[model samples]
Target: MSGGCAVTLDDLTVALRALRLLAVDFPHLPAPDVDVSPVFPEWLRLSLHDTSCESLSAFEQWRTALRIAPEAVDSRTQSGGRTRVLKAEGQFAGAVIVLTAYADEPAADRAPAGQAGGVR
Candidate 1:
């Protein structure tokens, strides 16, 4: 739906597959934990942006939603890690997706360690 040109799910899928290939070949990409979109090497990010940019917002929403329902997540018996489903109900067409991304720190957004009462 960009500039009156409809971008479809299939187009996004192809772009993702290419990005996956790049990730497999490239190493040490920054975790996709920056704000909403996963951080990647700039070149890779630009490449993905060029590919069906219409759906990026939908992807972010799904990622955030999964994080919300922690209890519903399945962690494969692992400690401190649980997998969740992305319903894709709103914008991603009829795809029920499970996203695989770097896990967030147990308290990444909380107060720094060893500090109390707003004092260092």
Candidate 2:
């Protein structure tokens, strides 16, 4: 909340337009299951290559360069791994959601190979 572009009218407008303009190349299959909670945040972290959720907005912005959110949801596909997409600018985090066909499995709860589920 203290870092990155403050959520403002201009910023929100800019954010939404960016989202609408992106071409994420989602799979063609019907989006199986979408969960906007835990899934979304994890997606942002992975896409942005960040260990902490603190830098998510920057991740979102970075995604803009690559093209990428404020929502923390889950999307599950039949074979494609679960992919997370961010919903930025409060409105998006709560409003718009995009879906693609390809999906694997939800890696949200998967622990490191040798670590226990709750170890981290």
TM-score for all predictions? 0.22, 0.21
Q: In candidate 1, residue 100 scores what lDDT? A: 32
> Candidate 2 lDDT, tens digit per residue, 1-120?
225645434434433443443334433222223333332322211233223443344444443443333243333222122332333222333333343222222477444455443211
- lDDT minimum window of 10 residues, candidate 2: 41-50
User: What CA root-mean-square deviation does each model show from the true structure?
Assistant: 16.0, 13.3
- lDDT by residue (7-119, candidate 1, tens digit) is 55443553365455535743343333221122221112221121232234434543454343534433221123221112221112222233333222234433444543121
Tell me the number of clashing residue pairs for each predicted model. Answer: 2, 23
Output the worst ten-in-a-row residue range by lDDT, candidate 1: 41-50
